[model samples]
Target: MNRDQMEGNWKQFTGKAKEQWGKLTDDDLDTVAGKREQLEGKIQERYGKTKDEAKQEVDNWFDRNGW
Candidate 1:
């Protein structure tokens, strides 16, 4: 899925994000408020991942079955 799709499907995406980044708390996802960039920023802040790395991980989740 593309960035737009990710934003549009934020509820699902955030759940997947939490599952992928187990370190991320529900509060962090809520604080990001479904904004893709903010979510990425939060992910980086929480996980110490580079922007591209986080984006790649999110995209990989999207491509995965049952995500």
Candidate 2:
């Protein structure tokens, strides 16, 4: 899904996101609120990933999920 679609459907994706990134807390996902940049930031913070790594991971997740 695109950014707006992801944001719109965030509640639905949160479960899968948690599945993929188990280190993230509910509070972190809530803070993300489906904004891609925020999601990337949270991934970076929780996973100690660089910006590019987080972005790439999100891209891969999006491609796999296609939601």
Candidate 3:
């Protein structure tokens, strides 16, 4: 889903996000709160990935989840 839609459905996505990025703590997800940039930043922080790579991974996750 788009950012707004994702935010609106944040609770629903939390479990899936945690499943996908198991290294992320609940605090990290809470900080993200469904913001794409925040999620990307968290991914980068937790995975040591480049910014673009994190963004791509998020995009791919969204696509796979039919969001």
C-alpha RMSD of each candidate structure in angstroms: 2.5, 0.8, 0.6
Residue-level lDDT tens digits of model 2 in 1-67: 6778888999999999999999999999999999999999999999999999999999999989865
Worst 10 residues of 1 by lDDT: 58-67
lDDT of 1 by residue, 4-61 (tens): 6656777866766777788888998887766767877877888899999878776676
lDDT of 3 by residue, 1-67 (tens): 6678999999899999999999999999899998999999999999999999999999999989998
Ranking by lDDT: 2, 3, 1
Off by over 4 Å in 3: none
lDDT of each: 0.74, 0.94, 0.93
Give the TM-score of each candidate: 0.68, 0.95, 0.96
lDDT of 2 at 35: 98
lDDT of 1: 0.74
Candidate 2 error regions (>4 Å)? none
